[model samples]
Target: MKTHLTILLTLSSILTFSQNIKIPSDTMVVTTHTTTVKGANINYTASTGTQPVWDKKGIPIASLFYTYYERNNVKNRAERPLIISFNGGPGSASVWMHIAYTGPKVLNIDKEGYPVQPYGVKNNPNSILDIADIVYVNPVNTGYSRMIPNKEGELPKRETFFGINADIKYLAAWINTFVTRKSRWESPKYIIGESYGGTRVMGLANELQNNQWMYLNGVILVSPADYKLYNTSQPVYSALNLPYFTAAAWYQNALPKVLQEKDLLDILPESEQYAINTLMPALAKGGFISAEEKETVANKMAFYSGLSKKVILQNNLDVPTSFFWKELLRDKSGYTIGRLDSRYLGIDKREAGSSPDFNAELTSWMHSFTPAINFYIRTHLNFKTDIKYNMFGDVHPWDNRNNNTRDDLRQAMAQNPYLKVLVQSGYFDGATTYFGAKYTMWQIDPSGKMRERFSFKGYRSGHMMYLRQDDLVAANDDLRAFIKNSLSNGKPAKYEKD
Candidate 1:
């Protein structure tokens, strides 16, 4: 398997076209201010501490640590825009975005996440700090950030790191201190989130507005998950059927002769329309129709999706993504394909039955860069610390599991009535279906008359669309334009139809 997963400049902050993790000693001169906030103890004061990377023995080491950075209206020849960024995993670090994508200086990448040696880091001219001063945070466990250990530096997995409410509360308090120190009460603040980070950002947006009586200027949700809990849980069998068939057809150039005649862009509308209007309705009516009728419908759907009618009938019109992997690439070697995107072929012909092709693009790379970056912060960024980086912390399950769409969305909208949401997705991103976002946008009040406030574009890649240079460049352009217009007029163009 020739893994194309070389250096992917996974979208966002503090990195670059760079190489090497061990960083040289440098002083950050990280500044701070002080204030009080309501916390578990109510004695939470805004203070800056040189977070040290502590050893298992609870000894402070000059490895990787975190402190605090604040400067409200950072007088950038004028008042600066305030922006806070974070990475998602329910337990990931914010360094990925803060250090790699938005900070003043960044690690390097060449359009892709490939390293530009001589320390794989550089001054990111593209850093949005020019317009929005950025604050990057590390959640409880993921980075060098850690908590008191129970036994032998080993933390409590259950009590501390296993749920969601605790996560948000701490994050809210952390932000309070962060903002108090910087005195950014006057600047227009914004939040940028990626992947699961989108969930965190939106959730945090609600918290910030509700608790602090503060509102953000805008929000940027990258590859958001509106309802993945239920969406991804769709009858896995049918869930697998559509996208797999679509990806297979795209890969084979076997789309309907008519769709193939036009460009892929032109064909997407019908494809998306079918998924929403036709396939969705059919699936919702599963078991309602007679077996014979179901078979007929499945076959017609198969032809429309470019799969063989026999294959459709075989799976009873609900061939899962896994089976599509085998069926589509069966002639080649019968290897199942990757889940993140079926374009990746596997070794086995049928279901893994036992194992699978590298579960996803993010798994390995996320594992790769995470520790390296932690080490980088300790040595290079030089804040000081002893906090564990909870790359994917246990969610405040209660808070998010029963998340309120109207309350959450309303709070966010009402807080930043002028909030502009810029969302982008890849058409092939079955992970966070592009249509789901479109649908969500349709549901939000601001989204209805705020079309100009929100903008979405689809590319031909998977969830991490930035892996492709063209898609990356196009997205960057759209973002730059969006940022520029947003600063000029805080209110987005009122929602309108495309």
Candidate 2:
């Protein structure tokens, strides 16, 4: 009996010693920094850390990496507004926005956004830190964020944070954890998302408020994509793209001499009016329309889009953006214009192809940003980690199954009447056209009751408009005004300028 008892006690002690115990997460590295913008000396705290994600049963699921910046000396941190921002690739890290426009430091790239050699970064004079503290979050499978090892000692599958609904849940949890951990629960919150991130913030606003019990003061969407409105399967999507086509044509001087001479802003509405009233119905009618009607529609599309009537008719009066992109520049040099930024042009090995070899606009800045981020994170911020940073990592099998966020945003507004939204886009951005964004906003709040809380501003650049020096300043200025207006107690005014 004594020998059996001894064996049992020895086995129990061995099992306890072999089990992996959870030590408290390593202390995060915090760097204090200062930068003067607009003649204000801003003392700020820059901290790069990971926030653990927990499941329903409180099991740790993942670690979300984030770079947080908060301005010091604020009399009331709770009264100040905080902006939580992220970039979207479903796989992209938040570095694009952080290094491009919002963070204290920005990449010193050229006017066209191509890198100047020696790949240098400098303090961003236009940083939004003057108005609000910023947090740049990298979702799972992107940047330094990753899944925690499970009992099997394997990482969780990407499904945990890659889907539309799952993404919102994890991100909402991260935001809640971040605010609570930092003790900024009382602060006025805002969210800024670019590209798919823009799509993300819409859903996140609702999720955070309804599920997490957190309310926001405002939401800023930069080049936002609307899955509902941008559907290529619908005839309306083709029609909605006309204004952008005209804008791109205008930029390339491919439009009619009369149209080219007119101010772009003045002539764009003509294109919008034509697409809405004429092209939309004709396309919807399809085969039922008379031959004469089809001919007229084709001619009008050609006139506005700078495409030949023959090609427009060949496509059945509906030219997909891919065909237009390739066809527009084929005659000129067999070069294709970029979809992200129509301003940039590239050559394709297959000149007759419908799409370009690659997106010139996207490739232009990758060289500069990738290296700059890697260097800055390690040398400047002192956030050391062996994990490879994913500037545009593969989050493949990317669950794009559900992309609708109109209802989510609308529900958020309905729940919190004080919530304001500002959508800023560039005229030259083909990825998420300004017209498409406007249509989506209108669809979201057609009654116009929320009109007072919404604002749409357009710039003369591409998807990442801040790459242009002038647009960067203008966007920052507009954002500054928007943030102040949102926090004001006065009734919000309608910002739709006809």
Candidate 3:
């Protein structure tokens, strides 16, 4: 009988442990911290936690991880602005901007954004937290966020969270819950997205208004990726790449002596003008163009792109970006440039290939970011978890259909006179070229009536421009100016004539 009792006791203990070990779907851990930003000592509260995404029946389907930073001792919360931040990839965590860009801490890297030993994070003196509160959100399947299995052990459908329209729909609903929970409805709100997040905030601008009845004061796009411009065989897509090539070539000192001698900013306008006026039309002609015209276009493309005329004409005047990356430094240094940042160089097995073996910048970024995020979350923020921090999560087969986000932003701006936009891009960002970002801004409002509400700023870095120390200071200052300038300040939300 004693033996039987011992067995039962052991079974009960095991069950209790299992139940206790289950991760909480809705929970938060609050910690207090202080930092100096722009020469001001600021006290802030950091709330790190997970919130649930419920189904139509109110059943928890997924939980999203997020970190919220609120400046302490505020006179009035409603008067302060709230910035909701997200990083793109449709599968990337919020780690990039969380510990690096606008957050109070940044990765321990060199001034020019190269990885260093003793990987960890340090205080960012340029953090914009003093001017406004910030929240970094990790979407479902990224960071510690995960989908919950039902009582019957069935997971939610992929269509709910892995697509363009679906992403906007559910995220808008989630934002409503977050805003309501924090009692921030009255505060001036801004949504900022980087890379794919650019596409995201554009859609959210309208969705938050129409679906959630929530409006925003500003929308910020940093190195945004517009799908409409990408994933297409359109001539504009190929033509817009010229300016980016010029920027990359200038950085590598691959341009001709005359053009290379000029500043990158000075030479970029010439490339832009030629791309719009000359290259675009020539490419649009396709096979019907005269032989002499093709040769002339190829000669000019080689001049701007740093590729030989033979290579340009060999491809019939349509050069793939991959070829440019591999061939840019082929004869000069026998190296391949990075796809995202072109500033980083890679060694290839054979220099004759059309593309490099790996993305040098991404690999280098992971070396620092992966370790830094893991260490920061556990050490500084005091949020401990056994779950792996997925820098890049498994969210493949992403549905890209029905993406009308660009027009969505236009509609939002048209309806809300108070809504404004600020676009920031890095000159060396080859993935989503600065020129492509400008083109997107131009196409947003065809009527051009609300053009003044938009602004564009460029940096002398790559996709993650804030990674560089100098650009970090400049970028955050730009953000501060944008936020301050966007404030309504008792002005009514209606159009007025000067």
Candidate 4:
């Protein structure tokens, strides 16, 4: 009887212990390395870790993975600035920005940005680490970050962190925890967001400031998805896409000889003017516009874009990217222009289709960046985990409810007078065209008194401009200058228009 009771008590204790083993709040692995940048030897510490994000009720909701790098031998961390970087996809991990562009190491790709054979990585001499300490954050459901699954292996509760505002909430929590943990509250903070992350940055500026009482020094928006300037329907959508259309056509040498010889900048303003003044009004009028006027508009659009006037008129003078990409180079070789980088071409079985079968540019780099990051994590950073790294996880049913971040950005600028903004765009990026970014920034700061605080730069590459070596150098130089000016409380230097 005594032996039986002892066995039952031991079994119960084991069950309780198994049930009480909670997920770890953080798992950190630190490594040190040295790299040469511009003939200067720099040593830095790379911290690969996961930080827990708890809910308002003190319940652990998600674990966010992050890579933090700080220059070694720095006497005062308080004087150093911290840049938190992320890529956008609503579901994307930070690997895109980490292994491909800004991080100390970049994928060894060709000059044209094609991944090299045997897939590897190399030191990025232009890495922004030379100036500021950077932390690449992978939000919940991205990279190794995930929601704690229940006993049934279902992630029902983690769905809340997948939305726009909820993402901001948890991300803010993680950043707060990191800053507090690292003891760098006095350091100037910056946010570097690419694509959808750009929208996140704007919301974060407001959320972090209002909720967490953390002030930011500057924001770097790369290929920003400014929904305020976005429209899905015809006319407005096409109008918004006009400059990009012109850019692609120019790149493919499909534009008329007169426009082809002209510099891209000269053509962009014309496209913007036509888009806002002519195309928008005509599209808004709908049936009210005369056929003659529509014919004239179509002819002008054809001249700027490579599409025929008949095709433009058939589409109601509104050529969405889907149709334009297929139609622009269709006559020459039956190939479709890439939506991300127009320089890339794709061969679709059905060339007559409205949209290309796939985005050639997006797929081209995935094979390289995906493997390179995985290799770097396990091999160089010495961070090992059984969980598969999710480069772009499926954060489905992502709620966009009340996600107007432009207002949040405006509010941040209004409240924080010293806060500056650097808006960058790749002229060849069909996603977030340069003119669209310019329009949004123009609308954001109309007074022009803050003009010194705002700088708009255009790159010669696609959405991920830094993938191009020259653009990476340019971007790095610009960022270094921006950081210097921001830390000194001086107005950011103006970027000469491209």
Candidate 5:
């Protein structure tokens, strides 16, 4: 599922690939190395900070290729703070972070998130740079980053992503170089990670605290995954997914009732409570129910799940994901929509015959980002590379299993008594669903008081809700408030921007 979220549909051929970028003679292509007991492998390049990229639209960006943006130039005016940010795909570029949150160029998203003109970047007056210097890193094989030539296929995919300990061991070595070279040892540090990066940050905090002897100031998790629920190990995962199904159904009006209510927070809890308290037991009964009785329950379930009764009962209440994709619109040429982003519902009405849902439906949009991002990078940020940026490179093969690092959570807070957090979720996001983050946080910070150290807000948008103008403004203001309150009293800031 994550692979699909990050995959690019190469078949579309929407844009032709440009030739390798020429490395200038005067420009030195530098390499840095870090060694782990696992092996000495990370590859990196650096540039002394330079120019502007763009004003946040499709407009031309003006930074020299390979130059780093020296956020420290304009000191915090008090103390120095360094915050590292990255998006999780394990394969996604930090573009979302750069363009949407910290970059000089920002898209003017609409209230409903339909893009409009004057589509340019903003100065990000609310940026944390007012409080800290932010550095965005693209993980290996994603964005303009790629595995060094010899190291390209040297390591198997599994070795790179599996075994939480292995991952942290390798990642820390790489990240340390960036921090060390920039002479940020004296600066208070923080990390911001989204999705898998969120999950990864926990372990990273542990390593940074214990191994690197660096205690972090704080960590931010946006739409994170707590593998305990996200992984396939739990049979109850199917059970938990039901509420999200209802949440999705409610938002899309897949439920029998129009559910005209505008906000998901208003509806999801009720439906979620119903699923846990009643519906789950009914579905668990399985063959005990008579055909007629089964049909009745199925209809009700469908009503709640935004699916059809016949389709619901067909698979013994284990209706496949594809059913949700196409069943809703079976009456409309079998049109199916994205489970991740419902924005671009596609036409795939033909019979899928109980087979897996078509994967390509969601890949196109993410793929579209590749060319667009490349164009912007080349034309604006003069930093160029010969490497083929893998928008969704499967650097590691997932076993479709779960190994949660929720315990690593407190190690972060414990290490840095000063750390505070804000977690944001999109009601419609299927990738790292809201409840999943809740479940993990509940376990991690069981004492509601410490848990209160974090504030979780819901958005009407999906995984990338920041793209929507309303959400973007809300997020900017909310983050600004967080920094403001944190700086003022060293307390967690609270804001509800649903």
Candidate 6:
């Protein structure tokens, strides 16, 4: 009888512990720390916590894990700027920008941004935290965030949190709750998103304004992924990639000696002009173009892309980026260039394949990022949870339909005079070429009425430009300037004819 009682008690204790590990809908763990940013000693409070996502009945349906950093001893918190940051992947945690970009601490990587051993974080000297309080938010299923089951053990429908529109809707609601809870309604606000996050924040800018009734002063897109041009085989899509190809080729020293001798910046304008004026029109002509024009375009593409004319002709002048990655160094070297950041190279089992076996840059990043985030969240932030930290979660079957996010940003800017946009992209980012980002920016406000309010900055590195030391400092400085310049300074929010 005694043995049976002990066994039952042990089983009950295990069940209770398991239930506790399901992640509380609303909970917080706060820790205080001091760090120097840009030679300024700063003290800040890190609030690592989970905020509940409620259903229509106001019942908790999910929990979003976030780390919010606010500088301590602010004279008036209402006047300070608050930067809400998110990384992309639709299913990616906010880890990339959290530690590597604008956060107070950064990954312990080398100056060039390659991962170093002893994977941990160090104080980011160039963190924008000195100018603004920042919050890194992980959407549902990413990081420690997860959906909750009801008393009947029924999970919320995946449709609520996995689609483009669905993501914007819930996150906007959550932001409203967060701002209200923290009493930051009067604060100047900016939303920055990277990659797929670019698509997200574009939709969010409008969603927050119309639905949540919350407005932002600025929107920052970091290597933004505009889906319209991503997988589409349109002439614009194929042509826009030419400039990026030129950049990657230049970096690899694969371009002709004439182009290579000229500085990268000097040669890029030629490539851009060719892409817009020559290549786009030529590609649009398709096979109808005289064979002479096809050959002419092929020769120019070879000159710009560092690929032979034969290969360019083989693709019929619409050279897929995958083929470029595979063929760029096929003769010179057997290495395959990375898809996201061409600076990184990988060894493939066979060199004759059309696409790389894997994304070399992503794999290299995961090696350092995965362990650092897991360690930082648990140890530094002191948020204790046995839940597995998902770098990339399973939020798939993602509904990407009705993507009016690009236009949504335009509308948001139109509605709010104080709203401004700053687009930053890396020259060598093949996945979402810098030129494509430029095209997206231009298309956002077709009227060009809001052109002055929009700005673009390009870095020499890849998608996560901040990973490179020089770009990190420059990028944060750019953010500081953008925030400061976008502030209303008590001026009324209205268009003025100067």
TM-score of 3: 0.95
Better of 2 and 3 by TM-score: 3
Model 3 misplaced stretches (Cα beyond 4 Å): 1-21
TM-score of each prediction: 0.71, 0.91, 0.95, 0.91, 0.74, 0.96
lDDT of 3 by residue, 283-387 (tens): 999889899999999889989999999998888778888888898999999989988888999998998888889888889999999999998888777777677
The candidate, 1 or 2, that scores higher on TM-score is 2
Q: In model 4, what are the clashing residue pairs, if there are any? A: none
Clashes, model 6: 0
RMSD of each: 10.8, 8.5, 6.3, 7.7, 11.5, 5.9
Lowest lDDT block of 10, candidate 5: 1-10
Off by over 4 Å in 1: 1-78, 98-125, 149-165, 228-261, 290-293, 303-307, 314-316, 322-327, 333-337, 341-355, 367-375, 383-400, 446-452, 488-498
Candidate 1 lDDT, 337-413, residue by residue in tens = 45544444446434434335444445533544565565555454443434444455443443345554334655677
Candidate 6 residue 269 C-alpha distance from true site, Å: 1.0
Where does the lowest 10-residue lDDT sum fall in candidate 2? 1-10
Q: Could you tell me the lDDT of residue 66 within candidate 2?
A: 83
Please write out the lDDT profile of model 6 over residues 31-80, one tens digit for every residue: 78888988988988888878888899898888888999999899999999
Question: Candidates 1 and 6: which is better by TM-score?
Answer: 6
In model 4, which runs have C-alpha deviations exceeding 4 angstroms?
Answer: 1-25, 150-159, 231-234, 446-449, 488-498
> Per-residue lDDT of 1-498 in model 5, one digit per residue for the tens?
001111111121111124644222122222221212113222222232221112224221111122233332443423556677777766666766666654444544445544445444333433344445566666544554432221132322344434555556555655565677667776766777888778778778777777777766667777786666665543334555566677766655666555535455666776667666656676667677677766766776776677777677776766655556556555644656566545436654455644325543246434445555555454444345564655565456643333445667676665555666767766666667766666566677665646656667667766666665677667656765665544424454344455
TM-score-better candidate, 3 vs 5: 3
Reference-based TM-score, model 6: 0.96
Evaluate all candidate structures by whole-model CA lDDT and list the values in order. Answer: 0.53, 0.82, 0.89, 0.80, 0.55, 0.89
lDDT of 2 by residue, 1-498 (tens): 001110001111111111453312223567778888778888888877666778787877777678888887989887788999989876889998898888888887887677887886788888989888999998876887767776767666778887777898889988998899889888878999998888899999999999999998899999998766664587656898899999998898889888999999999999999999999999898778899999999898888888899999888887888887888878876778889889988878889877777888888878788888988887667776556788876677767677657889988997787799999999988888888888877888767777878999999988999988888889888988998888855555333446
